[model samples]
Target: MKIMSVFGTRPEAIKMCPLIKELQSHTEITSVVCITGQHREMLKEVLETFTIKPDYDLNIMKKEQDLFDITLNILDKIKAILIKEKPDLVLVHGDTSTTFSTALACFYLNIPIGHIEAGLRTYNMTSPFPEEFNRQAVGLVANYHFAPTEQAKKTLLAEGKDPKSIFVTGNTAIDALKTTINPNYTHPILEWAGSSRIIMITAHRRENIGQPMEHMFHAIKRIVEEHPDIKCIYPIHMNPKVKTLATTILGENDRIKLIPPMNVIDFHNLLNKSYLILTDSGGIQEEAPSLGKPVLVMRDTTERPEGIEAGTLKLTGTTEEEIYKQFKLLLTDKVAYNQMSHATNPYGDGFASKKIIEALLQNKKD
Candidate 1:
């Protein structure tokens, strides 16, 4: 079976890279990767780490590309590829515009779609903005729903999706850790961290811009000011609003290093070295738990509630006081820190890629 795997962005690439490798190893499955180039430099870094050169690169990234630009560019570009390849199954990951647009194009062509990391929901579509809608919309057309957890499967079933089509394959994000993380890895950032604790921060959610973001930064700034034994590394997002807010609030601090986003290998190694994580992103909620790093999620709501249930994450709303309170507790309370850091990752056991491939192959057989 010829399976065309479609993804863009660093998060999609990181999760899908392991599955792509698994697909290529099987003689019975022909795997093709198509990158939307939604993110140029960051995406390239991830691809190089996995040694994955895409069969097709739709260079869709532009100066301040908005949601409309991404959707249309992918729709226009991916259509041509789909016409030429016409794979037996088209696989899409998570809830990026690439995933949604690619799946829509496939549906238009009557091509089968297999959605990876499917059935994540906040129900409040505006919370995660287009992402909540993107995943739910893709769920409507996907032939195979590869949910990350049992909770995800239940969500799909509750939404009236066919149970037979839904498969709980765990999360591919966990599988990625096995490949990207290196125990012996060393970088200048690690050296600069010295004997002090490293607090890795990644906050780039669309909804949390403006005042909400200011609140998060203020919390971080307060923590840094109070705690001299800690250093914070924030890989600022490409968004100008985020950058400006971060620079105005966090840039002045010598202890907080505002660097460009790190690649999968470097990011994974950094996560391994991190004493704690504060984020408002989705994938990190899954990734940090596997590394035994306690995460304080800087968001009001999250679709990935499995981490909360497993005791690896806590939801600190986008408020200055709330974030500061949670941040300080983790630093001060050893028992609380250890409990969260040591929780079992409900996401996967590093076999998600194999299971997903097996499901695909079995679908072909059936």
Candidate 2:
């Protein structure tokens, strides 16, 4: 069976790379990878980390590329590959434009789609900004819904998706940790963050870009000012606007380092060393807990609620006051911090790739 795995962006690459390797190893399946390069530079690091040289590179990244640009560009470029290979299944992950557009193209080509990390829902489309809509849209056409948790599968069932088509394979984010985390890993950042509590920052959600983003920054800035024993390292996003805001607000603090994005290995190592994680991102919510680091999500909602339910995450929302209170509590209250850090991860057991393959291969005969 021929299977094409299509993904773009750092989160997708990190999660998909492990699954791609498993697909390649499955004797019954011929795995092919196509990258949309939704995140060119950040995506590259993960691809290299996994040793995945893509069969196709759309190279769609541009200056100030919007959702329309990414969607249309991937649609135009990926159609030809679909036509040529005509794979038995086109696999897409999560709710990125690359996932939705590629799945849409496969739908047009009459090829089946297998959605990884499927059935996550915030219900509110405006909060996650297009992601909620994207995943739901993928749900509409997906033949196989590879949900990462039982709760996610329940979301699919509630949405009226076929029970026969849904597979409760745990999140591939946990699977990725097997490859990323290393005890011997060391970097200058770790050295600088030595002995002091490292508060890792990764806030670049589309909805949190304006006042919400400023609020998040102000809260972090205040926390840094008050807590002299801790160092905050913000490996910022590639978006120029995000960089400008991050610099203008979170800069000037010698303890706060606004570094460019690090590779997956470095990022994972940093997370492993971090005392706390503050983010508006999704992947970090899952990854940090496995490393025994507590995460404070600076957003109103999250699709991956299992982390919060498992006690590893606290949704602080995008407000200066609320974020400060939660963050400060985690730092000051060792009991609160330990409870979160020691909580078992509800995401996966590092076998999501194999489970996804088993389910796919079982159904491939259809």
Candidate 3:
């Protein structure tokens, strides 16, 4: 059977790359990759790093893009590719607009779609904004749901998704670690961290752009001032709005190195090197725990509650005092640090790609 793997954006590529490699290795499956290049440069870097040459490229990037442009552009461009290739199944990852739009296009063509990292829900639609809506919409149209954890499976079942169609395959993001993070890996960022405890920070969520992001930055700035031994490396996202906000709060801070977004290998390596992580990004919550890196989630709510329950994560919300208190405690208290870092990873054993492909092939036979 022919399976078309579609993805866009950096996080989607990092998570989906492992599954794509697995599909290609399987003798029974014909794996075809198609990139809706919403993130043109970053997507290409990931594809090259994974050595995945796309069967089709829907280069849908524009200089100044809005949500409507991305949705409509992918719809028009991918429809033709789906019609021409006509794969037996379309595999989409996570909750990006690309994943939802691709699934919608496949649904329009009467094709079966499989959703990877499915069934993650915060219940509140407005928290994650478009992501919550996108994933929910895909859940409706998807023929197969590859949930990352038991919690994710429960979520799908609670939403009344068919149990038989849902497979509790662990997250593909964990699988990506096997390919990307190497023992011999070296980078300028890693070198800068030196012998000091590296606190990796990534705060660029849409909901946390203005006051919330400022609150997070201020907390970090205070941490830097108080703890001279600790160093921070923030791989700032590409959004200009986030840049302006970050600049305002963290400008000319020597201890806090704010760099551009790193590629998949670099990112995985940094995550590996870091002592702890602080972020509002959804994917990191799943991926970080597997590396034994405790993630202090800077959000009010999270879809990945399994991590929080398992002690691999802590939700400190967006308030400055809350963030500062939690961060300070983690640094000063060894018990709190060890408890969080040593917790069992609720995500996967880095073999999630194998499980996902096996499920797909088994279904085709059935």
Scored by lDDT, the top model is 1
Model 3 pairs whose backbones collide? none
What is candidate 1's lDDT per residue for 1-366, written digit by digit as tens?
899999988899999999999998999888899999998898998888888889999999999899999999999999989999989999999999899999999999999999999999999988898899999999999999999999999999999999999999999999999888889999999899999999999999999999999999999999999999999999999999898999999998999999987778888899899999999999999999999999999999999999999999999999999999999999999999999999999998989999999887887789
- Span of ten consecutive residues with least summed lDDT in model 3: 187-196
Across 8-38, the per-residue lDDT of candidate 3 in tens digits comes to 8988998999888888887888888999998
Ranking of candidates on lDDT, top first: 1, 2, 3
TM-scores for candidates 1 onward, in order: 0.99, 0.98, 0.98
Candidate 2: clashing residue pairs, number: 0
Write down the lDDT of every candidate, Cα atoms only: 0.93, 0.93, 0.90
The TM-score between candidate 1 and the true structure equals 0.99
Off by over 4 Å in 2: none
The local lDDT score (0 to 100) that residue 2 gets in candidate 1 is 94
The residue pairs that clash in candidate 1, if any, are: none
- Collision count for each candidate, in order: 0, 0, 0
